[model samples]
Target: MVRPLYPINAPTYLRLRDQIRADIEGGCWRLGQHLTLNELSAHYSVSNVPVREALLQLQGDGMVDMRMNRGAVVLDVNERFIDEYFDIREALQSMLMTRACQRRGGGVLMQAKVLLGRVDEAMREGKVRQLLEADHALQDAIGHMGDNEPAMAMLASRSRLLEAFRRARLDLLTADLMQLPVQGLAMLLAIEHGDPGSGCEAVRRHVAAMRAYMKKLLKIPEGRSRADASLVNVPTFTRARESTAAMPEASSTEPASPAVASPGPPTVLPLSLPPGRRLDPEGDGSNDNRSTDDGLHPPKR
Candidate 1:
C-alpha cells in the first residue's frame, strides 16, 4: 500500500498532489490519457521536482503507469479494475469492521453520527465536492475506531480509484445516487447494534453497485477531447543544480505559531490533479469538451 507523507499544511508537492488527483477523478483528464512532466510543471506554475514526486504518489496508488518512454500515462477504467478495487476494499473494510466492533469505547459512534449529519446536509444542498469530502470523513471516523494502519492505508488506495471515477462522471451515470449516506447509515446501525456483519455487508453491497454502474458507463463511447487540455507553455526542464525550496518567512520578535491539529481524522485517500486542463477547476466542472484559462492546462498530439 502507498503511504502519504504526513501533510503539514500540505507542502507544495502534497498540495499539487491533491490538486491533480481532483482533476483526474473529476474527469478533467478523461479516461485514457498521458502527460509529460514538463507539461505539468508549466501548467501548475511549480517546479518539476514536486510534479515528479506527486506523480510517484499517484503511481503507487495504481492511478497511473510511470513508463520510461511515456512518462505518466493514465490507466483506463474497466471491469477488471473495478473487481480488483472492490476486492481490496472488501477485505480491508471487513477487517476494520471487526476491529471497530471489538473496541467500542473510543467515541467512534458519536463521531460517525456527526459526520453522517454533514453528509446528509451536503447531499440536501447538492454540493458534489462537499458531499464527497463528507462521505470520506465518515469512513475515516470508522477507520480511526479500528486503529488499523495497514487496513486504512490499503483501503485508501482502493478508494481513491473508486471515488475518482464516481465523482468525475456522476451526473451522466445516474439520476439518483444516494448511496453515500445509506452506506454510512448502515455502518452506524451496525455500530449501535454491535454487529460487524451488517456494516460489512452494507459496504459490500455499495461496492457491488458501483461496479455495476461503472460497467454500464464503460459500454458507452465517451468523446471528451483529451488533446484540448493544452496548458500554459513552459520551457524544457534542466536536471542539474536546481535551486532548493524557498524558506518560509519568519519574524524576529514574534513567536512561531504552533501547528494546528486537524479537526478530522487523517484522510486515507487524497485528491488528484491532472496534467491536461480541458476541465476548468474553477468552472461548473461539466463533462462537455471545453478549455481552461491560465490557471490549468492540457493538450494532445
Candidate 2:
C-alpha cells in the first residue's frame, strides 16, 4: 500500500496526529516543546478532536506526553531510551538482513545496485530528501527480499525510529554523511553478488560506522555511549498510548493537502512523492535526479 500524504480516512484528529508525527520527524517541532490542541488544530486546519487524537498517538509512540492541565509536549531524548531504541533496531534489522540473504533473488539484487547509483547521484548534488528516499528504497528492497510480510512490516516500522535518530545526528557528522555513499555503495555491491555472508558483514560494518560516527559527534565512546546525548537536556515526553486506541476507523474520502511548491533548480521527484510532499532544498527536481523504485514506499520522513 502507498503511504498516505495524510492519514487514510482518519478523522481530523488522526490527520492532525499524523501531520504532527511528520512535523516532529521533520524537526518542525523541537524536543521539550509543549503543543496545545488549539495550536495544532489551527496549524493543520482541523478540529481539536483530531489534534488531540494525534497527540495521543504520539504519546503512545513515546514522542509526546500529557499532563494534568497541559495538552502535550514533544519528548526529549534520554540516554536509556535512545540506547534501548537502537538496540531493538539492531536486533530486528540484523535478523532481517540474515533472512533476506538466505533467499534473495537476482531481481532484488539488481534493483539494489540501481538504487545505490541513485544514492550516488543524490549525494553528488547534496539532495537530502533524495538521499533519504534512496536509502529507504534500498532497505525496503531488502525487506521485501525477506519474503515475509511480518518481517517487512517490522523493518519498515523500526526504520522510522532509526531514521529519526539518524537525522538528529546528521548535522553533527557533516563529513560522514557526505561520505555515506562510499560505504553504502560498497555494501550494495556485496549484496548484489548474493553473498549473504558478505552482505551481513558489510551491513554490520556500516552500522558500526554509524554508531562510531554518532559517538564521535557526541564526543563519547562507542557502545557505552548513549544516543540520547544528542537530546539530553531536552524535555521529556508524556505517555499517550491510550489515545491511539481511541482513534476512529479510517474515512472513505478526504482531501489531500495542496501541493507544495517545487524546490528550484530542476530536481526530479518520483511521481509517488509528487508535488506537495515537500519543497526541494534546491527547488529544481531535475537538477538532482536519482533512480527511484516505483510503488507506495515506506515512510522515511
Candidate 3:
C-alpha cells in the first residue's frame, strides 16, 4: 500500500492539472508542442476524462492553447507575452500597494514583516524556490490587506506563471535576487507607514526592474531589430560584468555595497548562442535544426 504523492481525497482532475502544470513549467513541454489526450492519459496513467478537464483548466490559466484540431499546444513564451505580463503586473501591483497603504492594519503589517523575514532568510541561504515563494507570500499578504477581491483575483490568475518563468531563469537573475527583496522591503515599509504615494511608486519601480531584467533575459529588443526572430534558440545566462564590459558606466543614486555592486557595469545578461545550435545572424531559423517539439518526447519512467 504505497501512499499517493497528491492527496487521495482530492478530485482527480485537480491532481492531474497540478501535475501537468508542473510539467509545463518544468520545461517538459516546449513551445508550440501539441499535447494529445491519448498521450497525456497514457503518460499519467489516468483516463482521458481527467486529462482533458485538467487541460481545459490550464487553458483558462493562459498556460496552454486549445485549438480546433490541434488539441492543446504549449503557449509561446515570446516578447509580446512578456511585455503584456509585466504591464498587467505593474498596474495590479501598484493598485494593491496603494490600497494596502490606505487600509493599513497592524496585524497585516506584522504578518508582512514575518514574510519578509522569511524572504531574507531564503535569499541568504541561496534557496531560489523558497525565496520566490516567500516573496510571493509577502506580496499576497500586502494584497490581502487592501481587501480588494477583484484586483487580488486578477493578480492571482497569472502569478504562478510569472513565478515559474522567474524560477526557470534564475541564472540570469543573480544580481536581481538581492536587489528585488530590498525593493519589496521598501514597499512593505511604505505600506506600514501608510504612505500610499511612496508605496505605489516603490511597487512600480520594483516592477520596472523586473521588466528590464526579463527583457534582457529574453533578449527582447526595446525597438524592432533584425535579431528578434532568431530568439527561439534561447541563450544561456552569463555574468553581468562580462555582458556589459563594452558599455559606458552610468551614475547611480543608490549607494553601492560590496555584495550588490558589479566590478564592471550594471548587471545585464547579453545574448550568446547556446552550444550545439546554429543560429542565423539575420534573425531567421534557417540554419537551426532544433525541433519545435523539443520536450514532447517524455522520458520513460
Candidate 4:
C-alpha cells in the first residue's frame, strides 16, 4: 500500500512552519514586518532551530525576503504582484473547471451540493468561519475532480496564490460579496445537468466576478488597478444595518422551525407529619375537628 503523506500535525519543524505561514497569511506579520528568529522563538515558545526551519518555509513561499543583516521582512502586496496573482488565478480556475467537466456525474457533484448547503447556512447565520472553510472545501473538491494526481497537484499549487489574495482583502469585503459558494452551486448544477458549456460559463463568471470585485476594491480601472489605493466605499456601522435591512430574505431552503417539548406531568412526593400535627397531606382537615373511635382527648401529653 502507498504511504499517506504526513498531515499538518507532523514534527515540530513542520508545525512551526505551518504556524508561521498562517501568521503571515493572517496579517499578524504585516507587510515589511521584520520577524527575527529570536522574536519568533519567544513568540512561539520554541527554540531557534524550529523557528529557523519555519522561516525557511516562508522564504520558499515568497512571503519572506531575507536581508543581508536584517533577517526576514514580509513581502508587500504591490500592484504588479496583485495583477500577476489575478492573472494566474484566472487561468487556474478555467483549467480546473475544464478538468471538473471531464470528471462529472459522481461524488464530485454530491460534494458540491453538501458544500452549497454549508455556504447557505453561513450566509443565513452570518458565520464567517464557516463561510471561509466552505470556500476551501469547494476548492479542494474541485482540485480533486481533476482525478489525475499530476493535474491535481498543479491546480493545488496555483490555488494557494488566490488564497493569499483572499486573506489580504478579507477585511475589505463583506460575506455577501464573497460568493464563491454560490458560484460553486451554480457550477454543480450546470455539470449535473450535463451541460459542459454551462459549467464552463459558470466557472468563468465566478472568476470574472472576483476580478471585478477586487478591481473595484482597489478603485483602479479593471485592468490597471493598484493594490495600495484599492478600497471600496465602506459604509458606516449605522448604514451597514440599513443595508442589511434592505437586503432580501435568505434562501428558501434554510432549516424549518424547530419543535419544542412541553412540560411533563407534575411530580408526586411522600410526606411525613411533625409531632402534634394531624395528618392533612391533602389539606382537607377532615380528621382534625372530629374525634377518633378510641381517642381520649386528642392525645393530651
Candidate 5:
C-alpha cells in the first residue's frame, strides 16, 4: 500500500509490473525464479488476471520467460543481451546528438545540471531508488534537447531496465556510476560545440565503457566467438508483444535555469539500490529540507 516515488496513473497490473521489475532489478527477484500469477496476485492484493497481464508485459522486455514447466520465470541475461541494448542505445543517442547540440547552448544544459545534482543528493542521502529514477530523468532531458521523439520513446521503454543493469554493474564495479554524467557532459559539450560526430563518438565510448564493465563483471571472455553462442540453443524469446501498460515518459520544460556543473572524478557509490518503501499516500512524502519531487516526476501527458 505504498505509493510509487513517481506515481503513474495506471491500473493494478501495470503498477504491479513496476514493483516486480523493481524487485528483479534490485536483485530481490532472482534469476531462474518462478513468478506465478497466483503468487504475485496474492502479494500485491490484486486478481490473477492483472498479474498475468503484468507478466506478459515483462516478457516483452526480455526479463521474463514463459517456460512449459516453469510458467513465468525471470530470465538470466548474458553479455550479448547487454551489448545489444547498449548498441541500440548508442545508435539512438547518436541520432539525437546534432539536435541536442543545436538546442542546448544556454538554459537547457542547466536543466541537466540540476538533475545531475539530484543524483549526487540522492546518493549522499542514501536514497538509492530515487537516484535510479533521477538518472532516467536526467537522460530524458538530454534526449529532449535532441528532438527525436521515436528514439526517446524507445529509451523511455528501457529506462527502468537500464537502471537495473546499471545497479547490477555497480555492485560488481569498483568505480562510480560517474560514467553517466561524465559521458553525458561530454556529449553535451560536443553538442554545444556544434560537432555531431564528436558527440556521437562520446556516446559510443560511453556505451563501450559500460559494455566493457558488464563483460568484466559477467566474466565473459575477451574475444568474440566465431559464432554467437546465444543463437545456438536460443531459448525461445517470445515475439516481443506490445506492452499493455506503460510508464508515462518523464520530461521537463521550464522558464528558469540553473548553471551547468562540470563533471569530475566519480565518488564511490553503494553497491545496490535498496527496495523501494512506498511513500505514505495519505501523507505528503515528507516535510524535509530537500525540494519537492518536481525534478523526479514522470512527464505529464
Candidate 6:
C-alpha cells in the first residue's frame, strides 16, 4: 500500500482547500462541474475526511456549491460578482494608499523604487507574468507601509482568488502591460512626495482602468456610473504648510532672524505615453534609445 504525502506544517484540509480553489480558478473545473469526494480522494491520495473538509471550506468561500443530490459544483463567477469584488478591492486599496502615504519612511521609498525598477525590467522583456508579480510585490510593499493589520488581512483574504484570475488571463493582459509600469511609477512618485491625495487618486484610477479593461475583455456591460459607484471617500492629508499655518505662533524673547528662501518643488520626470502612439505589445524597435525631456529613458531590452 502507498502512503499519502501530506504537507509538513500546515493542516491537510487547508492545503487541500487551496489546491481545489486554485484548480477552480485556473479553469481546470468548469462552471457547474461536480467535484466528487471519491475522485478527489484518489487524485490527492488522501482519505475522504480531508477531501470532505476541503470541499466544505470551499463551499463557505463561495467557490463551490453543496447540493442535495450533487456533491460539489463549481460556482459561477458572474459579471455582478466581479464588479462587487473589484469594488471591495478599490475601497481597501484606497484606504491603504492613504495610510501608506501617512506612514511612508525612507525604507519604504527605497523598496518602492527597487520594485518599480523590477517592473521596468519585466516590461522591457515583454514578460507578462514577471511584470504582474513585480507590480503585486510593489503594491504589497506599499500596503505594508501603512502598518494596518486589519486592512491587510481583509485584502489578503481575497488575494488567492485575485491571483488565480490574473494567472488565467495572462494573454489578455499583454496589451495593457505597457501602461502598468507607468501607473506604478505615478503611485510611487505620489507616495515618495508625501502626497496622499495623488496617491489615492492614482489608486482609484488604476483600479478603474483595470476594471474597465477586464469588463471590455469579458464583454460585460458597464452597469454603473462613477458618480453612483459605492466607493469609500478616503480623506486626504492636509499639506504641511496649511497645517503649520494653522498653529498659533510660539511666544519667544529671542531676536527674530532674517527669513531664508525656500527651495522650489522638486522636478518630476515625465512618464506619460506619447500622444497618438498606442501601446504595442509587439515591439516596433524604433525608439529604443530615446530619452524623455526629464532625462528618464524608456526601458531598453
lDDT of 6 by residue, 42-85 (tens): 88899988988898887776667786645687765556766887
Write one digit per residue (lDDT tens) for candidate 1, span 46-94. Answer: 8888988898888887788887855598777778887887787777877
C-alpha lDDT score of every prediction, in listed order? 0.60, 0.53, 0.62, 0.54, 0.57, 0.60
The sequence of per-residue lDDT tens digits that candidate 2 reaches over residues 227-248 is 2221111112111222223434
lDDT of 3 by residue, 1-301 (tens): 1113776699899889878888766667655579999889889999988988898999898888887655698776666887898799888888888778787744677667667767765554444456666777877788888788888777776655654554445333354554455566667767767888877776776676666666665654222111111111223323333433433333466532312212552221111223554323221234423333211111255
Instruction: After superposing candidate 3 on the true structure, give the runs of residues whose Cα lies further than 4 Å from its correct spot.
Output: 1-11, 121-130, 174-177, 219-301
lDDT of 5 by residue, 111-165 (tens): 6766766765544333334554665676677778887788886776554554455
User: How does residue 72 of candidate 6 score in lDDT?
Assistant: 82
Better of 3 and 4 by lDDT: 3
Residue 112 local lDDT, model 4: 59
**Model 5 — TM-score against the truth?**
0.58
Top candidate by lDDT = 3
Residues 1-301 of candidate 4: C-alpha lDDT, one tens digit per residue: 0123567678787777767766765667766688887888898999988777777766776677776545678776555666676576566656666767766745666665666656545443444445556656665676566555665555443444344545555334342334554456556655555566766666666665556555544542222122222223345433335544654443568632322324653221111123555332222234435333111122345
- Provide the global lDDT of candidate 5 against the true structure: 0.57
The CA lDDT at 27 in model 6 is 66
lDDT of model 3 at position 170: 33
Q: What TM-score does structure 1 among the candidates reach?
A: 0.59
Q: Highest TM-score, which number?
A: 6
Model 5 misplacement above 4 A: 1-10, 68-70, 105-107, 114-138, 165-182, 220-301
Show where candidate 1 strays beyond 4 Å. Answer: 1-16, 26-28, 45-50, 118-133, 170-183, 219-301
TM-score of decoy 3 = 0.64
Model 2, position 17, has a per-residue lDDT of 61
Candidate 2: stretches off by over 4 Å? 5-9, 78-82, 122-133, 149-179, 182-194, 215-301
